[model samples]
Target: MIPDVFAYERPETREGALALLAEHGDEAKVLAGGHSLLPLMKLRLARPSLVVDVARLYELSYVREEDGFVCVGATTRHHDLATSDVARASAPLLAHVAGQVGDPQVRHRGTLGGSLVHGDPASDLPAAVLALGGTLVVEGPSGRRTIDAREFFVSFFEVAIAPDEMLVEIRVPSNPGEQWAFEKLTKRAQDWAIVGAAVTRRASGVGVALINVAPVPLRAAAVEEALAAGAGADEAAQLAAEGTDPSSDFNASPEYRRHLARVLVRRALQKAGF
Candidate 1:
């Protein structure tokens, strides 16, 4: 499959890229690492008239400490995250998920912002972000706005980012001593998860996020609430599918997905020593 002909512009600055998006609006698409968008474009599922490439925006390609949180630029590649000592020490869950995203080639080219902004329900990073309670910084003509990861994803391949906005950075607080686990079930090592679970426990509370359980990456509210109420891991994990409306697809039946969700949630909880 070939993508429809489209104009491309490599923006050296973030504002330049934003300007392109501001002008083209719905007809434009942002190209970060291009791992996700290029595939959709190649299949003709997305045929934007213009591609605003931000890969060369050096300022948007870093992993740094901001205040007490780790601020990752939108163009920072997954391989960087997977290999960064700062990320591994403070946000081990993110580093672990990054390594699990795809094969080495995909990780070398896939960006955290691209994965989160692409908003695929089965993606690893989004679920990890949700579990880690991260925030997305989106820049637009009106300036910037921050959206919590839990509220960032709206539906399958859908996010809260406006058409004219571009994700600039992701911010996550350091969780050095937190217990975390990510469990994904897939037919092949590099394949997308059929169903996945990410669990994290801090001094405050436990967070449980599910992948491929609904229209969007979702935190298991029922399970979280049960944990908060002092329920055991097995008891809380049994409710992992509560309120989810998963669809039956070629890879799995709705019931099968629900079952996987429960199994993975329980395993994640156990690994987190819940």
Candidate 2:
């Protein structure tokens, strides 16, 4: 498949990119790593007239500890973040999930900000961020703002980012002593997860998020509330699909997805030592 003919602009600076976005409005699409958007464009599902390439924004390609959280620049590649000492030390779950995304080639080219903004329920990074309770920062003509990961994914293939905004950074609080784990069930080694679970147990309580179990990457609120109410891991996992709205596909029925969610959540919690 070929994408419709389009004009492309590679901005030299962060402000330049934001300016291009603001200028083009709805017709412009931000191009980061392009691992997600390019495929969509090739399939003709997203036919933007202009592409504002921000891949050259060197200023937005870093991973470092800031305040009490680890900050990842939006243009940072998955391979870079997965191998980053700062990310690995401060946010192991995210680092590991980054490595697990797609495969070697995809990891080398996919951008962390791109994946989050793409809002794919099947993606690995978004679910991990949700479980870690991270935040995303975006810039637009209106200026900069932060969106909590929990509130970022509004629905299937939809997010909180405005059309004229370019995501700039990802921030995750330090969880040095937290027990965390990720479990993904895929039909093939490099395939997307049929159902995925990520868990982080902190002094406050446990945070659980699921991938591909609903229209959006979802925080397993039922599981969390159940656990907070003194339910055991099995009991909490049993409610994994309580508030979810999963659909049936050739790969799995809704009933089957619900079952996988329960199984994966239990495995994740057990790995996190419940």
Candidate 3:
């Protein structure tokens, strides 16, 4: 399939990209790695009149440590995150999840920001970021603002980013040596998870997030509350499905996904040393 005819602009700077987005508004789409947007365009699910390519914006491709966080540039590829020493040292859960995304080719081409902004509930990176309690930074004509990862995903395939805004960076608390684990249930090695769970123990408490168990990637609030109340991992995980609303699909029924959520959350919590 071929995408509809569209004008393409490769911006040399971040500000230039924002300018293009502001001018075109929702008529324009920002292309970072294109893994998420191109397929949708090919299917005619998306037909933006303009594609503002930012894949070469070097200023938006980096991994570094600042203040109390590990900052990752929006355009940084999954492979870069997986292999970044800074990410590995400060945010191992994020690094591990990045390596587990699709296969080598996809990892090499998919940007972290692209995956997050696509807002797929089944995507591994978003759940990882959610569990890590990260924050996203976006820039538009007005200026920059930060959004908590928990509040980023609004609904199925929707995010908080405005049409004229471009996500610039992601920041996760520096958690060197933090205990963490990710569990995914898939029929095939690279297939999307029917259900997945990510757990990480931070100074605040244990963070738990679920994949494909709701309209948006969601935090396991009931499970977290149980843990905070001193429930054992076994008991806390039983509440994994308490607030979820998974849909029945070819992969699995809603009830089945709820069951997997409970099982996997328990595994993840225990594996993370909870």
Candidate 4:
């Protein structure tokens, strides 16, 4: 299928991209890797009048550690994240998850911000970001503001980023001693998870985030609470489906998804050495 007709602009700098976004407003869409957006466009699900390409913005293609956090530029490729020693050292969970996304070709081209902003419930990065308590930095005409991952994703394929805003960076805390695991349930290795779970140990608490169990990726709040209350991994994981309202889809039944969520959460928590 062919995408709807649209004008394209390749911006070489962050400022230029943001300015284009501001100028075109809702009619424009930012393109980083185009892995997600192009498919949606081909299906006519998205038909932006202007496509502001930011793949050429070299400054937004870095993975580095600064201060107490790991700062990843929005345009950094998944393969870069997966292979970067800095990213692996500072955030191995993120690196591991990046390695599992799509195929090697996809990983070589897909951007983290593209995946996060696409807000697909089945995507690995969003759940990992949620578990890592990541923050997104965005730039608009007014300037920049930081949005926590919890607040960044609002609904299915919808994020908190304004039409005039372009995601500029992602910040994740350095949790070197944290135990983490990413369990993806799928029929094939490269397929999206029918259900997935990411578990990590925070300084004073545990973090559990689910993938493909709802309209958007979600945190397992009940499970987290159970863990916080000193429940064993078995007990806490039993509550994984307590608060989620997973829907039945062609790929899975609601009951099956909930069951998978519970099982995957348990396995992930155990694998994380909880």
lDDT of each residue in 59-176, candidate 4, tens digit only: 8889999888999999999999999998898898999999999999999999998999999988999999999989999988999999999998898889999999988899999877
TM-score (all chains, Cα) for each model: 0.98, 0.97, 0.98, 0.98
Instruction: Estimate, for each residue in 1-274, the C-alpha lDDT of model 3 and write its tens digit.
Output: 9999999999889899999999999899999999889999999999999999999998899999999999999999999999999999999999999999888999999999999999999999999999989999999888999999999999999999999999999999998978999999999988888999999998778889999999999999999999999999999999999999999999999999999999999999999887
Task: Report the Cα lDDT for candidate 2.
Answer: 0.91
Worst 10 residues of 2 by lDDT: 242-251
Clashing pairs in 4: none
Question: Which candidate do you rate higher for lDDT, 2 or 3?
Answer: 3
> For model 2, how does the per-residue alpha-carbon lDDT over 113-212 read when each residue is reduced to its tens digit?
9999999998999999999899999898889999999899998999999888989999988767778899999989999898899998887678899999
lDDT of each: 0.92, 0.91, 0.95, 0.91
How many clashes does each candidate structure show, in the order listed?
Answer: 0, 0, 0, 0
Candidate 2: give the clashing pairs: none
Q: Candidate 4 — what's its lDDT?
A: 0.91
Off by over 4 Å in 3: none
Per-residue lDDT of model 1, residues 49-107, tens digit only: 99999988878888887697888998899999989888898888988899999899999
Best by lDDT: 3
| Residue 7 lDDT in candidate 1 | 100
Give the range where candidate 4 is weakest over 10 consecutive residues by summed lDDT: 242-251
**For model 3, what is the error of residue 248's alpha carbon versus the real structure, in angstroms, after optimal superposition?**
1.4
